[model samples]
Target: MRVQKIWGADIYRDGGSYGFCFDSDDGQWYEFFLKTRAFEPVSPESHQPPIIYRNGCNSGEVVLRLSWEEAQAFVAPLRYENRRFMELIDIVMTSGGTARRH
Candidate 1:
């Protein structure tokens, strides 16, 4: 499946994590979360890092995990949009809430 667009992205300073939302080719929208530490590689050959997503079962005890490669494929088509989201995040963070984007 391909990503149509990234609709939202945010860095949670208090939680020390990042989250993003995107639409897929199947006409479904997904929101996923990742920890800051996930960006660090466990080994040199580790390419498929994991990401976390809240489970929809309402149990508040489970999470769905996906690999980095899988996440990459999900956002490949809309890579530029993801990049823009990150850029906006950086600007907002560095500017101390003086800048905004929508």
Candidate 2:
């Protein structure tokens, strides 16, 4: 599905990035990830959403932070929600939430 249409209902584009929170379809209490797409836009003044971050990282973890940033850092924004993205995102979200690993 087109990224915009799939989650556009809950997504917000700001500056050069697009972001969304893990809100349920009911739309409530969604803990948002600030500036989740860590890309520097190709078109600086085009107003188009930026691409995803380079291979995704936590931008160098601190003594109190993991390199993955607990999903706090915006990874590259996905152009399409393909299966690979699903799997990777599952890993990201699970690890971020400190949930039981599969």
Candidate 3:
């Protein structure tokens, strides 16, 4: 089945790369990866362009590249939730409360 939604808390970002988990229509979970690069202009009159690369995990840890638009669709929903969660964590920590593992 196709992926239906993504979980906000499962996303990880490191520099120009990102990874996230999603739930499919069949109720299965999977992870995806995205990496971006800024390419310099080829000539003095040109402007820099951004390149985004997307990938999905296959069986046995293999990752296959996907289109940028497809990857963005999967990740878009989680953006706000992810930021909100982090803000909540920050509030808790700053208020002298320690975050504990469940």
Q: Evaluated with lDDT, which candidate comes out highest?
A: 1
Q: Across residues 24-57, which tens digit of lDDT does each residue of candidate 1 receive?
A: 6777665555444435555332122334343311
- lDDT tens string, model 3, 2-100? 656756433224323334555777666665543322233343311112122223433435334444344344334443356533432332233312223
Better of 1 and 2 by TM-score: 1
Return model 2's CA RMSD, one decimal. Answer: 13.7
Error of 2 at 19 (Å): 20
Q: Rank all candidate structures by their lDDT, best first, as comma-separated numbers.
A: 1, 3, 2
List candidate 2 segments past 4 Å from native. Answer: 1-66, 70-72, 76-79, 96-102
For residues 1-102, what per-residue lDDT tens digits would candidate 2 score against the true structure?
112323321223453222232323343322222233324444222222222321122333212222444342433454335443343344344442211222
TM-score of each: 0.45, 0.24, 0.38
lDDT of 3 at 18: 36
Error of 1 at 92 (Å): 20
lDDT of each: 0.46, 0.31, 0.38
